[model samples]
Target chain A: MIEILLLVHLILAILVLSIRSLFTAVILMAIFSLFSAVLFFVLHAPDVALTEAAVGAGVSTFLYIWIVKRTQKEVK
Target chain B: MTTTLAFDLIGYLFVASSVVSLYRVLWGPTIPDRLLGLNVASAQILAILVLYAAKEKLHVYLDVALVYDIFGFVGILALTKFLEKRHRKGE
Candidate 1:
């Protein structure tokens, strides 16, 4: 299970980097955080899980979306 | 021991399904579809947390799961609101 979760994390990171849309990348990042939090919990670190759940999944996602919302797309 | 094994099996099932659901997020034709996939993924994570808490006899994880649900809700809400405003702005 741990290995599977780690594999998923790697896939998400690559997808975030390769995806065309910034919005999609932000959403993928939130998912990445979600799994990492779960991984922390599974590894017996509930404190880190709590922090990651709040800061990574919640605050960072909102902040990223906010930044993405305000920025203009670069011209090709 | 069987119960632990059962919980492990269920966790694997949830993980597999969530992974399959990522297909929607990756190939989604629209923003809302990706958001829906994200919602599904978070819910599955919450379930896995509860399963672990039960399996290992750790009550504290219950609180983590609760807070995670709340955070997922708020994150999705904020994303939708941002998308709505962007839609109104025409890009």
Candidate 2:
């Protein structure tokens, strides 16, 4: 089960990097964090999961969106 | 035995959903579509956490999921507010 999860995580990461849209990529980055958190949990590292969930999925996504909002080009 | 099978079944389903959502994240023509994809991705992640905790019978994993819930909420809220501010600022 855990190995399958790891495989999924690797696929997601590669997809995120190869994608064109920055926003979509950023969101994948968020999901990537959750994958790591689950991986940590499966490995019996609750403390690492706690931080990954709190910071990776939480703070970083907001910051990425903020930067995107600030720097996004106007459509028209 | 049956319960574990059920849990794995649900987990696989969620993994598929996340994979499907990746398309939107990869080539969403508009910003809103991509945002929605991201939102769905996060929810599916929470579901995965719940399923795992239930199957493993771990109290601490549940706690981690709760913290994930709170942080994910805050992240989305902040992003929405930022976008709204940008909209109102006439950018």
Candidate 3:
């Protein structure tokens, strides 16, 4: 079960790098943080999981989305 | 014995379904479609956590899942707000 989640993380990281849009990449990164938090929980580190969920998924995602919005090109 | 096996199976199923949602996130043509996929994936993740916590009889995992739920909600709220603001600016 844990192995499968790790595999998903691997695949998502590769997809994040390969995506063309900055917005999609940011969203993918958010998903990455989520799965990693789960991974930490399964590994018997509940405290780490909590921190990862709060900072990685919550704070960082908001910050990345803000960055993307500030730098994107307007569509015609 | 049977109950444990059933819980294990359901957990795997949820994970698989989340992977399927990832396909949409990877190939979605529009921003909203990707966001939809992301939302589905996060919900599925929450389900998995709850299922495992029940299976292992751990209360701490439940708290982790709760924090995860709160963070996911706030993150999505912020994301959509940013998107909405961008959309308005585009007009």
* TM-score of chain B, candidates 1 onward in order: 0.94, 0.88, 0.94
- Model 3 stretches with alpha carbons more than 4 Å out: A72-76
lDDT of 3 by residue, A1-76 (tens): 7888889888999988877777778888998998999899778898899899999889999998887777873322
lDDT of 3: 0.87
Give lDDT tens digits, candidate 1, residues A21-45. 7888889999999999999998999
- The total of clashing pairs for model 3 equals 0
Model 3 Cα shift for residue A76 (angstroms): 18
Query: Which is the leading candidate under lDDT?
Result: 1
Q: Which ten residues in a row have the lowest lDDT in candidate 2 chain A?
A: A67-76
Q: Candidate 2, what DockQ?
A: 0.60
> Arrange candidates by DockQ, highest first: which order?
1, 3, 2
Q: Please name the candidate that would achieve the greatest DockQ relative to the true structure.
A: 1
Stretch of 10 with least lDDT, candidate 1 chain B: B18-27
RMSD of each: 1.4, 3.4, 2.4
Candidate 1: give the clashing pairs.
none
Question: Compared with the true structure, what per-residue lDDT tens digits does model 3 show for residues B1-91?
Answer: 9998899799889989988888888788898898898899999999988987898888988988999999898898877898798699874
lDDT of 1 by residue, B12-73 (tens): 99989888888888889998999999998888888899988888787899889988998888
User: What lDDT score goes with residue B61 in model 3?
Assistant: 85
Q: Which runs of model 2 end up more than 4 angstroms from their true locations?
A: A1-4, A11-25, A64-76
